[model samples]
Target: MKLSHKLYPFQNSDPTRKSLGDIIILHGLFGSSKNWVTVARFLSNFGSVYTVDQRNHGDSPHSEEHSIRLMSEDLEEFIFDHKIQNPVLLGHSMGGLVAMYFDLTHPGILKKLIIQDIAPRSYPFAYDKEIQSMSFALDGFTSRTEIDSEMAKYVTDSFIRQFLQMSLDRNEDGTYRWKLNVDGLNHARRVFDDVFTFEKTSETPTLFLLGGESEYIRDSDFGVMDHFFKNNHKIKIAGGGHYIHFTHQTEYLEILNQELSFHS
Candidate 1:
């Protein structure tokens, strides 16, 4: 229940009006609500937008337990506490998996769902080397520059390194640390080996935005996807990678508005 969030409200000239349904935007693993600043700003023109930091990420309290089921249940609690009625759930990667689980388990709560760059199938992940590199880069860091220098040795992409650095938090004592719960995350990753299965269908309208340059979703995966989703739209953003919302914001938003029909 230590989830931190930011609420972006739509601009109303009339000063006495409210928008339509609320939008709950969930970020991927090692991500926070800050990543969706642009998306939330744009979406706020249509409705109230709430961007949350999932457990073990951002400002959310670190937890020893992390999984799709746990995160989804946390989401349900957030919905109940906030008293948001049938809000749209928009998530990317790990967040997307959480959204799928939440919608399926709590049948009548979701208004619409937008999952970006993730499928319902089990994704092949090999994180040992990356985790090692991360530990090495994060250890004994006095400044962000020091961490950047260390991370540069392993992560070649400048953008990705910078993005990863966002998860780093500096202590009042000038020491740096990661906001992610690496131990819990490793456990959650192992659980994903036996990902959730959809034995039944639901009518919740869902839109899946795919990264054309990413291989997360395969043609074969759509069979099981179609079986579970009764009303859904699958879109591919050309030249976009895993973080399509950041890599290709303009096109991503355009497709989102068109597919989800969120317009002001």
Candidate 2:
């Protein structure tokens, strides 16, 4: 049940005031706790915020397997270890799939749920091309520009290339390494693809946000999604892509604040 976590408590003027609800952020595959700092920091003003490094990512211990069930258990253990009560579960992409599983299995643990850019169904499209691209660039590159040049050939978007590049680290021997557990992740591709599926539905208030330009969620997944999240509202961010939170932080933040207030 032990987790390598970095916790940041939101400071309030009145120390004696009762504990308000907190936010627990889950990052997508290949993403670490650092990915949610911007959103978490902004939400901290309302209450405590936590960003978790999922197993096999970030400073969190690496594991040979990265199943959704194991991930939910890790999250459950994390909440118990931190003694966080009824915290809001916020997740993006792969993280969103984890949140859905958690809410189904541990309904009482959350006050509300926010899922960004994913649905409760399997997306088996081949991402091996992207994985291959990452593998090629993970080796030693003399300069950042060299890395960008290689990534640009596969990633298409400049912003996403930059975001992915942030996870690159240079070793003492000058070889560039990725913070993500590449071998473990690439091996668990099928499991990752099969992570999301509808289970027991909960009455918890659910909020879904999507990037208008992304094909991750659409009319096809809407029927299944509506089944579980009966009291749900999906908001689409115009002029945004898959990582809408990053691309439209201000708009996303405003919408998030409004959603939190609605739940309160």
Candidate 3:
């Protein structure tokens, strides 16, 4: 599958400046490349930044099948198709899981790996309510407010409701429809809770960015992280939650730039 992407070319035009190679960013579930526009623009100063929409999300083609392995394969194809070399692969939440799987299966393909706010272990929580909300909204709403109202019943967080609303697409008749493949994602809900396992530890340099307010990465998960990534570094954003990049943009970017500079 050829994933859809938005590229931000290097901003600096000075010939004397050095290139930091490619930086590929993958968005989380129900997210599109648009979510990372600000980050991509900032990272563009270092290298060409490619914000990709994983399968079933954003402008990417939909599939009945969705899993970490399949998404990893899609990333592989996207990387090869665009001839991206030694890209600094970065992923957030669900996308981070895909990045880890890709590194585990196809080792040495990336310059460095960055996993944001997600651990290698399975999540206990399910997205049933969120899926239901999306399904209800897909029936077509007269206005974005009505959609938000309907989503609020399932998703309590205003920020998350607003985030999910970003995936809305207005139809010809002016009714709003979701851009994501809702049914496909609903079917694969269990996959999200599936644990990631590997026989051999990966040597690729990895950085794990944790959110202090988020329960996604627990203290116990550090052992799993160490077992998988032998050359891994962990950093925590004190005030950030699961969406650290959005909540702590300045701090997140500063840490990301510092880490990327180490390899550059």
Candidate 4:
């Protein structure tokens, strides 16, 4: 259960000044620790910040299999390895799902949980199209510009396509490939499709932030959310999409600061 992690520390000065609670950020599937750099830096003002790359992504070791339970165990070992306590858990998309599972299974390690734009219920979303596009680009890209041109056909958003293309790497032989564990992710598709399920018992304070335009979190999910998170508050940011933290960093940071102050 030796899980790898990357630690980034910063200064914080609250009245208590007693380690204003560490913040652990988790990225989504196909994403790496790099995704949380901006937000993590901002949160560092409130406490020490740690952004983890799940097993199959970034510098972390890759595995053929992936599961919420296994990811939770990895996180447990990570927290213990780093001796982190009362961490403010912030996770995006798939990362949020894993965070929810971790907080439910190991309630004592985390003080507060922040779930962004994802519900615990199973979602019908499909990443097949994107995966196919990535694979196509990986098959062979004469140059980065070629990959970008191909991706444009499937991905309309120039920014998102550019962000995704960052995962593509060129080898010494000039072959293009992806840094992600694509095969493992494709085979474990069910795990990605399955919605997170857990009984409501833990009384940990949780915040659910959803993007107003994102379909991931909707009014229908509120009933179950109310049941699962006894001490919970749900907020939606207008004009925000699934990637709210990135799309609206300043706004999201302001809300996060308010949340920290409430607990401070």
Candidate 5:
């Protein structure tokens, strides 16, 4: 029950022509609006676009509370504040799950809904070790080399290490701290239980895009996903992982264009 404190950071894209419409894109867990810059620029051709950095990620304010419901309501408030009429809403992974909860609670405002690489089910997460591992890496930050070396010990994946390193904020006093509230995320584990739970179907026209290589969405959850997102479309990006929008930008843009055309 905290203030909606202008939490997320966002970028607005100018359209090439008269704006076709408006769309808001939300990034996945540990991601920020910066990650979607390319996609935002590409999608801006079809409409004015908004890419947001959700709470605890990117440049957003770190709150003591983090939950899908809280984040969804924040989005709803943003839509109303901006007077964004029937804007297309797209979210990836954790953001996708937040989008689903938002639609379920507040329907009819969206022109269309797009969810990527997640389903309407509670996903089991064991991110504590990974998060602590990052903190553990920050034990002694004499230099970036020391930090990187410690991070390498905890996080073996070079790509993830590079991606997560973006969250580090440097102090004038020659110290480094994480931009994200890792402890808040640890406390938010309870919110996971409330990620996806409802019976009534949503009327918002929806598209579910997934990376074929991502294990986030299971075969069993497809039926539940269809149950809620009754008016929906589904696509799988071959050889793509969780970050389909980044890896398959062209294909992702084409699919988005097609959806825009269909809605138009």
Candidate 6:
């Protein structure tokens, strides 16, 4: 499947500056390329950045099947189709799983791998309320405020509600509808409970950016991470939550820049 993507070309004023190759960023569930526009623009100084929307999300073609394997395959196809050479791949949340699966299945295809706020282990189902709320919202709302109020019943976090709001689109008739494939995603929710098995370790240099306040990547998962990623380093952004890039943009960008510079 050809994924929908937006590219930010390197735009450094210095003519003497060399290109830093390609940087591909994958957003999390219910997220589109639009979520990474700020980060993409910032990374554009170093390399061309491509923010891609995985299947069943954004403007990408929706499929009944949605899993880490399929998404990784989509990423591989996108890379090959675009002729991206050893690009630096960054994945957040659900996207992180896709990146890990891709590297594990097709090692060395990526120059560097960055996994944000997710571990390889299976996670407990935590999106039931969110999915239910999204399903309700899909019926169409008169206003964004009304839909936000409905979502707030299930999701108390204002930040999460705002993030989910990005998936909404206003119809031509003025009704608000979810742009995401809600039914498809609902059917594929089982994928979240699936674990990534690692029979062999990947040699690709990887950076795991964890959030200090997030439970996604806990110390308990460090052993599994070490077994899977042989050439890996981890950094925790203090007080940052699952959405570290948004909650701690300065620290996140600083760490990303330093890591990419070192790898380059």
Native RMSD of candidate 5 (Å) = 3.4
TM-score of each: 0.91, 0.90, 0.95, 0.91, 0.88, 0.96
Cα RMSD to the true fold for all candidates: 2.2, 2.4, 1.5, 2.2, 3.4, 1.4
Weakest 10 consecutive residues of candidate 3 by summed lDDT: 189-198
- Tens-place lDDT per residue, model 1, 156-217, is 77887777778878888888888877666766666455557657566898888899978677
Candidate achieving higher TM-score, 3 or 5: 3
Model 4 per-residue lDDT tens digits across residues 95-189: 98889888777766679999999877776538776676676636656888888888777777787777676667788898987777777777777
Query: Highest lDDT among the candidates is held by which one?
Result: 6
The residue ranges of model 6 lying beyond 4 angstroms of the native Cα positions read 137-140
lDDT of predicted model 1: 0.80
Q: Backbone clash tally for model 5?
A: 0
Worst 10 residues of 5 by lDDT: 1-10
lDDT of each: 0.80, 0.80, 0.87, 0.80, 0.76, 0.88
Best by TM-score: 6
Score candidate 2 by lDDT. 0.80
Models ranked on TM-score:
6, 3, 1, 4, 2, 5
Tens-place lDDT per residue, model 5, 1-264, is 221222232223433335557888887776777777777876766677878777887667788878888898778777777777888888998889888888888878787889999888887665764576566645457787788777777778777777677777788888888877777787787765756656767989889998988878778878987888888878998988888887788898898878776665
Candidate 5 — which pairs collide? none
- lDDT score at residue 233, model 6, on the 0-100 scale: 88
Candidate that beats the other on lDDT, 1 or 6, i.e. the better one: 6
- Model 3 global lDDT (CA atoms, 0 to 1): 0.87
Ten-residue region with minimum lDDT total, candidate 6: 132-141
Candidate 5 error regions (>4 Å): 1-17, 137-143
